[model samples]
Target: MEQQKFEKMYLMQTVQKTIVILRAFTKEQPKLSLTELNKKTGIGLSSLQRFVATLVYEGFLIRDDRTKQYQLGLSLIHLGKLVEEESSIITIAQPILQQLNKATKESISMSIIDGNERRCIMNIESSYALSARNHVGDTSPLYAGASAKSLLAFLPQEEIDQYLDEVAMEHVTENTVVDREQLLEQLQEIRKQQYVFTRAERIIGACSFSTAIISNGRPVASIAIIIPEARFDEEQFDELRELILHAKFDIEKQLNK
Candidate 1:
């Protein structure tokens, strides 16, 4: 009975309950009815109704007048726009990404390590049909991609060892380096060059290049570009490298203000 009261009290926290409701809708399930949301979230109908009422009032949620189906509202778009505008790095890098797209016609992406996973913060759509679009909230492994390696290279060896002990490399692909020695060697190269590049390391036909976005002598995040392995050329790297460096500097400069 005491545990039940404690759990119920904690569940009353608005932010915590909101996430439980909202996260139920994903790319596959983009909308849900009140009953469905309550079922999926396992919250009582009465309690869920009250929470939904608050969300609807706050404009974080909306209901269809005809069907009465509930979904995320325009307020989320407003909040997202505000986040994009307020983020120093994203604000500065947006135009730079545009300029890069014009110059290379390839997709560029930015990623940050969040605990044990990597989160893509910003990305530009690729013009080519063969190119892929990495979404902003997409999560990837910290040992799987060039951007992940760039982050690992910047972190201390002790930290890396501690992480490796838990993540025991399971091969995501035939090309992924599972051997600790080889991965350490790659990290060393990234540390020396301030960048990481891999051909078909994460995906069989895809290649990527990543660089650390450093501010105040520390890597705050990583920036990367993905290109088809068949399309990669050493000569093209020079132009892309310059553009990426400029973008990194612009983002860091915004931190000064």
Candidate 2:
């Protein structure tokens, strides 16, 4: 217990140090030398050198050899753009998601790619007492559910191939697809249809209908309606499909604007 506590404190200190090092570079001092950074961050010069070197190696900071100064790197710009896009997507899709949730009285959600996983960025709970439950910030494997597969289906062919080759496919539930070739085939079909409907692939008692939100001919996010299996009506599948697709269209239309 003592060792674990010490390790946790050490990790926290390392993270805080990293944040301080990055914060040392501001508009007033966009470029800083190791000495300047050490002074600004109040870290020892030796420790600061290690942190700055690691940051530079990771592309979070760039060092100018001639001037011996460091500045924020392109990776930070890319991360900033991603943050802006996620915020914009939520703002653009909120009303459409609200309407869809109201129409079906089921849980509605939006997901985006986060590394090799799909992350729920926005979610509206179902109105019914016995509805599917998913929370904002929930994450799931891309091979599992309608919410995940919708985004995965729209990725570039090479990226899709890379992901399939790299990530281990695990069955989240008995119905989850763990076969690579079968999953590839299913993704192809989803691409052709531009939507996916799945049952009990992630959560055991849930069904979801999902479609990608496209911008500039590329998928940026996915929208989903999640329903409890007990509440799902096969007879109403077509109506639910239409509502989800229309929600997709409306959100994408706004995204393209």
**C-alpha-based local distance difference test score of model 1:** 0.80
**TM-scores, each model vs. reference:** 0.65, 0.95
For model 2, the local distance difference test gives: 0.91
Cα lDDT of model 2 by residue, 7-49, tens digit: 9999999999999998888998899999898788899998888
Best by lDDT: 2
The 10 consecutive residues of candidate 1 with the worst lDDT sum are 81-90
List model 1 lDDT by residue over 1-257, tens digit each. 99999888887776788889878877877878999998899988999999889889989888887887888878888778545543866767678778877777888888877778778888888888888556799887788878788888888788888888878786767878888888889889888977777777777788887888776555667888888877788898877777777766777777655
Off by over 4 Å in 2: none
Residue pairs with backbone atoms closer than 3 Å in model 1 (clashes)? none
Q: Looking at candidate 2, what is the lDDT of residue 83?
A: 88
